[model samples]
Target: MTTTELAPETTGAPTRPGLTPAGLVTVLLGAALPIIDFFIVNVALPTIDADLHASTATLELVVAAYGIAYAVLLVVGGRLGDSFGRRRLFVTGLWLFTLTSLACGIAPTAGTLVVARAAQGAASALLLPQVLSIIQATTSGEKRSRALGLFGATGGISSVVGQLLGGGLVAADLWGTGWRPIFLVNVPIGLVVLVMARKLPESRAHNPLGVDRLGTALLAVTLLSLLIPLMEGRALGWPVWSIALLIVSPVAAVAFVHVERRLERNGGTPLLPPSVMRLPSVRRGLMVAVPFFGAFGSFMFVFAMTLQEGLHFGPLGAGGALTPLAVAYFTVSMLSSRLVARYGQKVVPLGGAITATGMVALLCTTLSAWPHVTILELAPSMVAIGVGNALAMTTLFRIVLSHVPTDLAGVGSGVMTTNQQTSLALGVATLGSLYAALSASLGSRDAFALVIGAVAVLAAIVAITGRRLPDPRA
Candidate 1:
């Protein structure tokens, strides 16, 4: 696969309505909703627990269940979009997400809410893959770069906005529904998205491959086994089943690899095309994405809790605190394309080092201020983190998708999205669990800062390693 050979496969034209700025905004909004929902719920969870009287284990499940289901099914969702139509899947997923969100809002018990959240995650999986695929299949050059940058910004911005808005909704208890408002708020927005999506052109692979049922199941099982225990085990005191599940994760994952290999060798479409795994750019990019997203997930989850439970900030306060991050992320993300073009791959590692510095600053500030610090005090560090995230996050997306062939765009998008979702879930589970465990001994606030700071350092290491990867051009 030389550069010339890959060049033809990368060219694409934007869909009819999607070619316009309004169309781009519509598509981006549809894409942003799902990502936003994933993180927004973190802030509202405490409110849900208090209002609904849900236990800690159930609350953990509420978050983890959604994340795991979304991660597992994302590849399948991408394939479905390819076989059917990206526009079709987008509309269907959005409607389902809206409905499920309503169910989540109205649920009377913790179990029901968790189930609804899982359904929401599944709908999200269906909706999200098509976003990148649509962008890949429908746009090229400056248009592609701009759309991708918006996607990157949306991802980082949503995490911050989700927390902020979730806090506002829960606190305002709009229409006196308390935490229910958080879920119900999506309905009107979904309806608008549905209409806009219908006007958007449909796109799909000319010759779509059949779904890989076995690979999908195995991937789901592997992720669930690994993620479930990590998220729930600590809160539940490390139960026997949790430990057992952790032990079984590797076995399940190994089994999955074997199954995928057999499928590929036999000429069947595996969940992820095996050829993708062999691509140097794809492989290295995934390696970089995993720890990066994992740390990201853990950071959002822990920070949400730290503000609410540890620092006793109100919903508005917690959400408001993240504003600096959102601003910084968007500002710096806009500059990432130019940076990558000029600086090449080194920009990513630079982003990581800057992010590391921000985290270190935050940790120091938090440790010194303890229970007395306000959002204003955290603003400077938050802005730095946001700037760092903006640079690294956008670069990561571009790097991963940079060399993918348009023919296999669907699966390629799926692979990258699944890696992201899984890492995010794992981050929340593993790093979140670490924070929870350490909080018991070190006090909640300090424990969270310490754990998050450590994870950020590790993410910096991953970024530095990514700098060594051969550029797609190379």
Candidate 2:
């Protein structure tokens, strides 16, 4: 569709409590919690394994289960929020996340923790979509754009903090609790958000669509079919069932699209509106988002293990290593919105190139340092990576949601978040699995560098694809 066609005229939708600044902070806190938990487990993996006497593959399951469950349920969660109420669903999700986190904290075994983590992921799925949907439905023009920028900043900052805090929490051993405090920390935070969230505005589609059970099931099936095999296949030594499931994934995805299309045609609500998928902004923005987030996930997972298991750093030492990245991401992200206003679509690919440059530096540094790699040696590259991440991340969300009709905010945000979460999970399952496999054969340093190289290549591709983004003036 033409730009003129895509930009729908504004309407005067009823607002609740004026979507106050305090309320926005509350929702962003809710956003930080889930994203934080997703990566926080990276540092704690070794501690959990030692504490529970779990196998390496089982530990992988601890991460994979949460990620997969989050990815699969995110879209449906968005649909529910759209149909019922955004504030209601967001609060409910936050409360459930708190309880599931507690379950993770006190779990007696790795299996129990894995189950609890999956529950936490589901709860996160419910909470995160609303942050963007609410912003999309309630705000517009520069305010909406800036809110989206902060969402991206919140995501990047949380990731860095998650890595940093996971190690800190593990090392502090609060009340001799070790890693338990990481999960337990959410309890008090959630309670506060629930209270503050009472002031947040509520909005939904004027003509809400009914839930599509068949499409939702098919989407779940499709994502699981792909993820289960990639994540578990390596651990199981490539079993037939894993290969079979991988083969079935594409078929499941096609079936899901057919179902969504049919639902839309029949005047029924689909899990994701097919019309949204056709938007140029979404199609192009994803080309950058997938690689950006996938590389990010792999970096966090690989670097945590490399620092602790390969280099023998202590928990705090490991977390401290990521501080540079956090600083750089926050610094650059704060500037990204202004840059976008000045540079428009060009800033995204430029950011990708810079990010890749950092990865390349990291690859060289890792190969040079080998087994004795230190945090100081990694700092410059980490800062570079952070810059790239901030620039691309801030604009990508705005680009994807730019043309979405206000009424479809929930579903649009759901689809956007689902892509991000799914890519993140895939990064762990695919690149993470690759790192693990190569670490066994190529040795730790070489394996880590090779993955960095792979990441750099992916970033370069994002830069090339990002040029296709619709012009801001359009």
Candidate 3:
């Protein structure tokens, strides 16, 4: 294809050389850190509560604060990268993340840790969008497909590794550090990545637009209104304020959309351009992303609880139980590009079907074995789900970005990541809440089985939706 047809943002030769092998590795390393941190705290929460004497509500805030801050600022972070420089923002974000992690490690009180965690989330917001934007801007054709596939694999594996690493760190309690090591460990790794990041090439929009302050405000308000309540409501006994915020969420969302559309029509850049959202590929890919990621997030949360609370396994054992899943996801993700090239869009629905089958099998196994179920028994189903997730998500990333122009890479990445992150939080809120509520009445085994069954339904929805996605190659 001609340059004009390939990327309207450029004319003549491309402005910069493609990303080097070292640069690809650097960006992918940066990408994995934020996702790992998100899940690493799951196994550390109890230890933190005990060490800091935090109330149950405060413990929840440790997780919610990070999530809310990260989700709220993501698009703005992406915009900043596009307007300034992706490399500049990436370095800045990594620096901030390192400092905040130190703060979290040494936090003297519960309130201090909560604030530090929120700041860490903000740093993550600044860091993550740049990874996807960089990949989009710096690679193409088979190389692009391969890079995106690796990125997908990194994300899937990081979630599982986070908990596993967290458990190991907490169990080791290096020098009696207890849960502090989880956050502290990021410091050395972040510093190392910052040094390596110098190899990365900087890329940004050729005609960058000014930040949309109104759009930013509205989007933040919308997300905070929805996410905060869902994240904290059940834990706080569904207080009046939480209920009120939930009521306000949709109104803010509607206003945000209206303002964005108006800005685009008036010949101005909005935080999220309606033009990008209108792409058939972007639209369809995101529709499937919601349920697929939702199921993934909720399964991780609930299964962690099942292993620890129901089976009375320690943190290490609980995290280790997921090994089969992680291995399968990584192995499959490595080969997904070739699979997609051969099968086209058909791979996505097939992945969803496999995921649903795995979930059903898991449910059956849980119901039959109940309290006696072992990791060995869970391995087969976990592998199936992992393989399915690898196939679906790796291709889904390609499908979403397939039609986006280079000038809009940051916006597109921001939009996709925001959708994925929001869906994950919602999944944890909705299905996690269901499991908690039901476990009280129906018992843990039955409650878990019911929730897994729901996840199967979600996978089936993904299967149905996947059929509508256009092939990325086309």
State the C-alpha lDDT per candidate.
Answer: 0.76, 0.78, 0.79
lDDT (10s digit) by residue, model 1, range 1-474: 000001123324555555556667777787778767765687787788788887655666787788778877877777787789888998898999999989998999998998999999899878877777777677778888888677766766776678678888888988778888888888989888888876777877666678888888888888878877777776777899989998888998998899999999998878777788788778888888778778777887778778888888877888888778877887777787788888777777887777788888888788899888789889998998888777777676667667777666556666776777777777777777777778778889768767877777776886678787656444
Model 3 Cα lDDT, one tens digit per residue, 1-474: 000001123312223777888888888788788778877776676678778987545655676677667766777777678678888998999999999999999999999998999899889888877776687678777887898677777776787788689889988889999989999999999999999999788888666567788987888788778766776687679999999999998999999999999999999878778999999988999899999988987787778767766776666776677767778887888788899999989889989999999999898887788788888998899999989988898788778888898766556766676777667767776787778778888987888888999999999999998999999888
In terms of lDDT, model 1 sits at: 0.76
Task: For each candidate, give its TM-score against the true structure.
Answer: 0.89, 0.89, 0.87
Candidate 2 Cα outliers beyond 4 Å, as residue runs: 1-16, 19-22, 132-157, 198-205
In candidate 2, what are the lDDT values of residues 1-474, reduced to their tens digit?
Answer: 000001112224535455667877887888898878866788787788778987556676688777777767777676677678888888999999999999999999988988898898888778876776677667767776777677767876787788788888999889888889989999998898899988888877555556678987888788888877786788778999999999899999999999999989987767777888788887777767898888877777788778887777878877777778877887887787688888888888988899899999988887787768889998999899888877887688778887877756556656776777778777877888888789889888888888888989988987888888875545
- Position 86, candidate 2: lDDT: 80
Q: Which candidate is the best by lDDT?
A: 3
Per-residue lDDT, model 3, residue 20, is 88
Model 1 misplaced regions, further than 4 Å: 1-25, 55-57, 132-160
Off by over 4 Å in 3: 1-26, 45-65, 107-114, 132-160, 196-204
Look at candidate 2 and tell me the lDDT of residue 168: 87
Query: Candidate 1 vs candidate 3: which has greater TM-score?
Result: 1
RMSD after Cα superposition, model 1 = 4.0
Cα distance off (Å), candidate 2, residue 311: 1.7
